[model samples]
Every structure is written in C-alpha cells, then in structure tokens.
Target: MTWTFEEMDRMFHPRVVAVVGDKKDRDYMWLRSVSTLKGKVYSVQVNPEEAANIVAMGFPNYSSLLDIPEPVDYVIVAVPRHVAPRVLEDAIRKGVNGVMFFTAGFAETGEPEGIRLQQVLTDMARKARMKIVGPNCMGLFNPRWGLRHSPEQYYDDGGPVGFISQSGTHATFFSLVGYQHGVKISKSASMGNGIILHADDYLDYLGQDPQTQVIAMYLEGVPNARRLFHLMQEIGQRKPIVVWKGGQTSEGARAVQSHTASLAASTALWQAAVRQANALWADSFDETLDLVKALCFLKEPVGPRLGLVAMTGGQSVVITDAFAKAGLQVPLLTPRSYQELATFYSTIGGSYRNPMDMTPTSRNLDMVRRVLDILARDDNIDAICYEFNMGFSAREGMVERLVDLLGEFREAYPRPFLCVLSAVHREAEAVGVRQALAQRGVPAYPSFQRAGNAFRKVWDYYRERRERGATRPAPAPAGPVRPG
Candidate 1:
C-alpha cells in the first residue's frame, strides 16, 4: 500500500522525540539543533550530570525513556553497543514507535558476538512490531525539521531531493553539497549497517513522503535484496531513484564488507537490481546529486529537442556534445524562436541555427533574457539550456543581470530551464543570486555537463511519472522541496 502524507508526517514531525545515551558535546548539539525545527524533545540519559547541560539546551532531561512524562514518538539511541538493547527495550515498553540506533560496534566489528547482538535486536524489533533505523549508523537528518544528526552541520532545508547513504561521511558531504549546490533535503538518513532498518525502509518512507520530489541513495550493497527490489519497483513508479553503489572494485568491496559487514553480492545481481528498480545508476556523488536536483526541479522535456543558448557558439557546441553524451536530444531551434532572438543581437560569423550563439555582442540582461524567453516559448522546444561564466562578463552587475534574466524567463516560459554557471563566484553573491533564481522555479548547476545530466534525469522522471499516471505532491512555498 502507498503511504500518505498524514502517515509519514508523524514519523518526522513526531510530537515528542526522546534521545537516549549520555549527551556528549557533539551529540547534544546535534540533538538540540534538530529539536529546534519541530517537536518536543525528552533527553534520556542514565547520568544526571551529562543530561543536565543537554536539558538546558531546550529539552527536558530524563534518566530513561520510560521516565519521560510525555509519550515518545521517536527515540534516538546513542549509547554503547552493549547498552543499546536494554535502552531499546525500555523505549519499546514506553511504546516508542520509531528508534534510530546511532551507536556503532554491532555487526561491523566482524565478530560473532557483534553479529549475534545485531540479530537479537532485529528479532526483538520484529516481535515488538517496532521499526528500527540503525544499530551501527550515523543516523538521519531532516533539514525541514532542523535535524543535523551527525557532527555534520549541513542543512539543506525544504529541498525535494532525499538521500539514503551507507557512509556517514557521504551523508555529511552530500548534505553539504546539497546546501552548496542549491539542492534541498526532504529527509536524509544514513543507515551505516543494515542490522534492523535497511535502505528499503527509508526508500519506502521517502517514496510516500509528500516533501520528497526525488530520491537518491549511496548504497554499498543491498541488505535485503528482495524487499529493496519490491520497494524500488513501487517507489520508482512515483519518483526517480538514483543509486551510486560504492563497492565496485575488489578493494572497495573489501572495505565495504569491513565497514558495514555488507556482502558485495554478485555483479549480475547488482546490475539486475538497477534494471528491475528502474533506478538510475550514477557514477559518482556529483552525478547522483545533480540528477536528483534536476529531477526535483525540471519537468519532463517534451522531446529530445534541447534548445541550447550560450554566450558563444563554442560554448553551445560543447553543451550540445555533452547533451548527446548524456542521452539527451539536442533539437534545433525552430524558425520562430530563431527569428525572435535574432531581433536582439547579431549572429556574428557563425550559423544562426539552433544553439543560438549571440557571440561578440554586448552581453546584457535584456539580450540573455530575450534569448531564454524566446527559446522557452518555442513550440518545438522541450526545454531551454543556457550557460553563464564569470570573468567572461562580470562588469555591469553581471550576476544581477543573470538573476533578473532568470526571473523574467520563469515568468514568461512554462517549460523547464536548466542553467550552467560554471565559474566560481563569491559564496555570498552566489548564494544570493542562486536563491533569487531558485525562487522563480529554475534549477541551476555548476557545469554544462552537470546541467545536461540534470536535464536528462528530469526528463526521465517526468516521463516515468506520466507513464504511471501519478501526480507530484503539491510542494510547499519553500526554496527546497521537502516531502511532507
């Protein structure tokens, strides 16, 4: 059965969240930050000394989960591995529905005792009909709710893209990149070892989450292949799922085995999983994030017809080639759009064909805006792709001009607009400019190749959703789309 917003909402925005374990300085900060977003937090620790400072950070301190006066909706356990089962039992007796075990040293230790411990936890959870997030994991972070779980303080609030990663560092890095790259998080969880809750659980949750527009995963190997495949099939029908497996090489596979006690499984099985789930296999973290970001913003391109507009034909030719490599259609501009853009600038020496290159001409906001407007309005065009680089023309408020052009284009055109601002700019300026552009519903990337790849994914997602006769959840008026 498909999960709904009302159901999923309770999972993230729980009425009361109880955090178990002595609050270390780091863990306390993470807990406090997340508590700020929504919900009341009951800090549970055995030691009153440790809980004292944590209680001061805007949460009530309790000796144990059962001691909390209010009903705890979610519990995050960060105690020693040996102490976890007891704490989990307490949480269960207290009727906690969800628990995220952030402590490590279960199965990942590669000892028989560790494996046994994990199995015990799993068995207890199943018998209790309670859901466990992780036993050896970094845990989850939902920016919309102010969760920064790990020591990683990255925040990508209200973004449509959601991530599930095996690596804690990957979880932290990707979230940082999502913040840096203009991608937002609906909800992100790092399932370090699939002791109890596997990737499939979070995948299923994100599939049903109203805030999540697209899903991305950094998988080492599938924990429960059968369940994952079924979940993927169902989730893929509604939204795009991009996965980047880490254990590809023999050495990498060995690392994954030791890191998470994850079996690499057969290559054939992995390949089949990709196809069966209808999931896109991304090559790297950048590609995974780029594609997810694209899917979050752009709609399906009508056809392969990509209308490329750049400051120069060289840039256009480069983007066209990248588009082809990314399996995108590079449709030539129709006569109407071509003629409309022609009124604004000279074509110089190059042919005035599709990748409309307004080269050697003064690069002004009106010139770029008119080109984007005309191309986006074209009946033959499916989407508009443009490139802008700093130092090429930074004078005369170039950033402001680009931002204004993006604003006007969004107002005039209804199709997806993919922009590539490949150069490095000041962080403050870039953030302001990007925020402005994103406000108008445009998706921007750091490079032309990335822009092309993003557009391709967006097109695929749009097509996939259309084929399934599904509609995207109505996104709230937020910069990043968050699944409710």
Candidate 2:
C-alpha cells in the first residue's frame, strides 16, 4: 500500500517526540536528533544523576517514557536491547504511532534468541497497531519539518533529494555532500537492518512526497525483491530513482551481511533488476552522489552529442577521448560553428575539432561567452562540457571571470552544461571552485573524464526511457528527445 500524506507526516513530524534512552545515548540523541526536531520534544532518560536538570537544552528530561506527563506521539529509543523492549511496550501502551530503535543487538546478532526476540517485538507492535522504524537504525531526518539526523550533520536548507540508506554512515555522508555540491536533502532515513519499516516502506513514502523530486537509495540487500522492483518501476515512471546497490562482489557481500544483516544480491542480477525497474544505478558511493547532483542541477539534454570547450590542445584531446570512452559522442563541430569560434582563437594555437581548444591569451569571460554561445546555437551538439584549470586561471585573474562566465553561459543556454574544474595541489582552492560552480547550477568534477562519465549516465537513462516509451520529465518545457 502507498503511504498517505497524513501517516507519513505524523511519522516525521510527531507532535510529542519522546527520546527514550539513558547514559551516553541520552546525550547523543538529544544533541543529534532532538536538537533540530520540531514539536514538543522530551527526553526519556534513565540518568538519575542529571534527573533534576529537567530544563537541559530547554527540554524536560523525564525518568521514563510513561513518566513524560504529555501524550507521546512518537518514541526515539536508544536504550540497550534488554531495556529497549520495555520502551516499545510503553510506547504501545501510550498509543504512539512509531518507535525508532537507535539500539542494535536484535536479528543482526545472528543468534536464535535475538531473532526470536525481534519477532516477538514485531508481533507486539503489530497487535497495538504501532509502527517500528528499525532494530538497528538511525531513523529519519526531515529538514523542512525541522527533523534532522544530527544537528552537526544536517543542513538547514534542504533541497529536493530524499535519500533512504541501509547504512547510517552512507546516509550521513550523502547529506553532507549537498553542502559542497549544492544538492540538498528534503528528507532521509538511515534504516539499519530495516527490520520493521523496511526499504520498501521509505520508498513508498518518498514516492508520494511532494518535496522529494529525486529518490536516491543506498541499499546493501533487498527484503522483498519482487515488491521493491515493482514499486520502483511504478514510481520511477514519474520521478528519477537512483539506486546504489552495495556489496556486488562476494567479499563485499559478506561484509554487507555483517554490516546490516542482509544478504547481498549478485552484481549482474541486481543491475538487471534496477534497469528493469527503470531506475538509474551507481556502482559506488561517490558515483551515487555525483548522479544525484547531476539530476538535481542539470537540465535534460535532448541528445547525446557533446560540445567540449577546453583551455589547451592537450586538455581538449583528453576531454574528447574521455567523452568517447564514456559512450557519449564528441561529434565534429559544424563548418559554420567552427568558423564562428575560430574568430576568438589566437594565431599561436587552437583547433576546429569537436573538443575545440582556445589559446590562453584568448581566455576571458567575453571570449568564453562567445564560444559557448556559438556552440549552443549549433544543432550538431546538444550539451556543452567546458573544461578549465582554475588554479592556473588565477594567474591571469581569469578565475573571477570564469566564475561569472559560468552564470552567463548557463543563463543563455538552459540545457545541460557541465564544468570540469581541474584540481591542483591545493585542496581548498579546488573546493572553492567547485562550490562556486555549483551555485551557478553547474555540476563540476575534478577531471573531465569524471564529468563526462556522469553526463553519460544521464544521457543513457533518458535514452533507455525513450526506448521503453516512458515519460521523461525535463526542467524546461522541452522533454528528453533523441536525434531523429
């Protein structure tokens, strides 16, 4: 069944969130989750030492979940397994909608008794009509509603990406990339083990979520493969679903099982499943983030042909080879277009090929604008890949010009235009350049090859959708089209 707005809303924005835990966990949950949460937040701690400090962080600290004088709509449990069952018991008794278990040691322990205990807990919750998020999970983070994974980790300006991961570290890292890449997290859930709510549950909620335009998942294994596949296909028809299936290799599969108590699927089988569901797949954690950033910032390209404008002849040759290697075409420039760009080229060097090179002497915002404009008007190319060395550009103070030039070029050509900002020895300098480009709606990569590879994935996704006769949405009025 699909998640209704009301149910999901209550799940994320519980009116009274009871933070159920003790000792070190009490501080961790309060500092991490409760610090940024909305509604009436109360800590249900067993720390008698600090019991008198009821107004710690401006929230009352109670002895137990039942002791919290108000009606608790949700419970965030971080207690031990022995103590955790009682918290769930009290939450059900309190008529709470859900209990998010921050504690581990149930089925993932691989013990018969531990497995039996989880089953009993699920049965108890089911009888009370209560929902459980995880036996070993970090729970949800909805920034729009003031929920967060951790106050120190989550960004306040959450954007359109809603991520659901089987790993907490993956979810945390994914959320942080937005700060550097300009992608944002509308909502996310680090669903460890996924004992109760499951990956499919979060997918169902995000599918109907208005704030979420792109659904990204980092999964170790599938609980119900058939159900997950059909659900992804149904939702993927409307929105882009990027899945990064972890543990494709046998060694990695063993690690994944140990990590999340999940048996990983084979690489070939999982890949076929993802493709059949019409969802995009990423081979690594970094690639998953890159794909999400590309989807969030880029306008759909109508064709696969690329226009590469480079700083030097060597860089141009490298970019051309990179795009070609990535299965994207770097077509020869049209005679008319080549003639127009050749006007800005110096007498020393340049090329009229697909990856046209411009002399350093001619590198400026005005010339870059003209070159980009010439390429944009060409029917031979559908997207532009502008490659530049930012660290070296600082010599001519062209770095400032390139920054402003990215905005102007993007405004003029509202199609998919990517920037390849080469990283020099200085890591901080590269970060500044990347952030600047991200602000202008351009997805930047460390190398031209990486940028081209990401763009190729975007093209292939739309191309596959077209072959299947599915609807592919665009940022503008024109949707994804092929070269007829």
Candidate 3:
C-alpha cells in the first residue's frame, strides 16, 4: 500500500502506543521502546500487573488497545509470525493507524504457508486502509524521541540524517559509526521482508519530514522500482540521497532474497534507476557511509574547482596525482591569487599554485592563515582540500592551532572544506586532529586517496546531475523476475 507524508507523521509522532508481545520482565523494556518512539509508551500485552513496572520506569504500559481508556495510535507487534497476523488484525479492528511488525518467518523463510500468512495480513490491512511497516522488520528508532526500536541496544534521537536499511546489521553499524563520527540521526528503520511497505514508502514520508534533511538508503532490492525512482527523484532534487545497492552477484541476489524476500533486481537496472533518479550511488559500505556523512555535514559544492592546502611539498605532489586518479580537477590558481599567496610565503619560501604547498618555513599559523585568506577570497575555487600530519610538532598544540585557524577561515568565508590528516603518529593524536577539523565543518579523512575519492563522488554526482537535468520521469513499474 502507498502512503503520504501526513499519515506517517500522525502515525509515528503518536501520543500513545501499544507494544503487543511477550511481556519482558526487564522493567520498561517495552516502555523503553515506546519512550524511544517519540511519544508516550503504553504496553498492550497479556499481562497488566507486570506492565506497571514499565510505567514506573517512565513508560506507560497497557494491556490492550481496546482495554486502554485512551485512544491508541500505533502498535508494535513482536510476537511470532503465526500470531502476528492475529495481533495485527486486532490492532486494525481497534482502528490503529500504524503497526511495526517485528516478527520473522514470513516470505523470507521460503515457506508457502508463511508467505500466505503474510499475504493474508497485508490484504487485511489494505482492506482496512491501515499502514503496516514490516512483517519481518526490526522496527523504527526515532532519535528525537529516544525510541530504540531494535533489540541491538542503541538509544538516542539522532540528528537529521534519516537512514533506511534492508539489513538490521547494517542499520546497527550505521548507528554505531554515525554516533562515533558525531553525525546525529533523526530516524532509522531496518525494514525486513517488505510484504507491503517498500523503501520508497519511507522515502516519501521523509520528504515531508522537517527533521529529515538528508536520506541514506541501503537496499538489496526494490519491489516497486518506478515508485522508488520517483520518490528518489523527488527527494534528490531537494535533499541528497545516498544509496548502496547490495546483491550484485547471482549468489548475493539469492542471499538477499533469503534475507528479505526481495526481488534482487539486476545491477544494470539499478544503475539505470540511480542515474535516472539523479541519486548518488556508492559501491561499498565505507563509501556509502562516507558519502552520507559528508552530505549531511558539509555544504553542497558546485563544480570541480578543488583547492588543496598541503603541510608538506612531497604530500602535495602525491595528492595532486591522487586527485587526477580520482577524476578531480586542480584548477590552477589565478596568477593574481598566486602572487598574493606568494607574498604571504615569501619569507617561508614556496611556490604558489593549486595544491598550494606551504614549505617548511610556512608551516606556522601565519603562513596557513595568509594562504587560506587568499583562497577564501577567490571565486574560481569551489572546495578546499587540505592535508595535515601529526608528529612531534603537533604535540606542541600545532594541530590545535591549525584547527583554530581553519575554523576562523570557515567563519570568515564558508565553503566545502576537507582535511586529510596523515596518521603517521599515534592514533590518539590523529583522532584529535581529525576531531578538531570536523568541529569546524571540515570533514577529515585519513588518507589523501580517501579524501580524493570522496571528492570524486561529490564531483561526479554534481556533473551527472547537471548533464541529465535531474528531473527525468522514473522508469515504469516492473513485475517480478525469475531466478537465473
């Protein structure tokens, strides 16, 4: 069934929810899930006396939606698949709008009985005009509400980065890494066994969500390719959507089918889908996560005008080649700008050009400042990429000083700035330097190649979008494909 923004908003942002499943003795576990839900938690299981412990722990648990005196908006079903159908039917009968099915043994199990059972539930919900999230899903996490939907043990209402992953492990990994990188998430959902709800359903909902500024998707396959593309096209024009399509090979496709009962559409079809939608496609998990983090934090940069600021001449040369390999252009600094930078480095001694190398003498704050000030004023450049090294010198607060200088430069003239710090010294020192750079709106990568690759992804996406006009209609809906 298709969904609009208004429905999801009212359903997710509910005042009270009923968690229907085996009641956990762990106080407030259901309440904790409800607490994380961005609304009041109410338990609707078999037992009432045990549910009070959840309310005492700050989450209201109820026995049933019908039994509860107050109106219930959402239901979380964590029972077995066989029983899930009954629970769902009960919720629908009670007039609940949304249901998060955390049960397994659906279509993914390759059992006809399970598939038919799921179909029965889906048919019932559609007939009743109610929205169902997943039959074999991990559930939803709203960081803002501290609603931790998964059993993986993550809590917090994250920032504006909305993540939708087909795999629960990937979702958990995303949460862990995002927290580590200081990238807060607004909403995260691990949608398993998409019986009725598809990825596009979530994307469309987020399109209208004020809290979801960027969309990051991890998909094994899409059920409604046309709808997914349309949603992606709509979302991409406004906010960046980064996608990592798994199941590239035949074996992998089978695995994805087993994992989520997805169609595992061909790689060629996915490539066309992404290109037509004007969405950014990442090859690996690292690339996918990096693109998402970068897009979420850094400003969208136009064109490939990349300026490299290097702490050493040798590293500068290395980065210049890396940039070329990554399809990045190093526009030569305008002669006027070069001379201005020259004047700043005349005492320290270094040539001025793109990949602007400040020699050993110019390694101090004043030299870095002069070069940054000159580049900041130039309109030819669109992004600034810099490299730093952590060694004996940085322990003397060299990294801190540079971070402050860069921060000041960003404040004075805002643009997409990146830092690639060489981890030649201790990991702690490298982390300190990376964190410092990140604190100023600059994304820090460990290697020049990584920085270059990320810049390439950004630049390639920009160019592709420009060439294709980025508003093409989505491909037509596709029927199920046979296994090869």
* Candidate 3, superposed: residue stretches over 4 Å from native: 22-30, 36-38, 45-63, 150-158, 331-363, 377-381, 390-401, 423-439, 467-484
- Number of the predicted model whose TM-score against the real structure is largest: 2
lDDT of 1 by residue, 128-226 (tens): 877777777767777766656754454435677789999888887887766665676778888888666678777878887877877889988875778
Evaluated at residue 155, the lDDT of candidate 2 is: 35
User: lDDT for model 2, on a 0 to 1 scale?
Assistant: 0.76
> How many steric clashes between backbone atoms does each model show?
13, 0, 13
Q: After superposition, how far is residue 424 of candidate 1 from its true place, in Å?
A: 3.3
- Residue 220, candidate 2: C-alpha displacement in angstroms: 1.7
Which run of 10 residues does model 3 get worst, by summed lDDT? 475-484
Which candidate achieves the best lDDT against the true structure? 2
How much lDDT does candidate 1 score?
A: 0.72
TM-score, candidate 3, is 0.84
Question: In model 1, which regions exceed 4 Å deviation?
Answer: 1-9, 24-27, 47-49, 55-58, 150-157, 329-344, 347-351, 377-380, 425-428, 457-484
**TM-scores of the candidates in the order shown:** 0.86, 0.92, 0.84
Error of 3 at 121 (Å): 2.0
Q: In candidate 2, what are the lDDT values of residues 74-190, reduced to their tens digit?
A: 787877787777888888877787788878888888888777777778788777767788778778877766666565555345667889999888887777665566667778998
lDDT of 3 by residue, 196-265 (tens): 6678888888777877777788999887888889888877887778889989999999999888888888
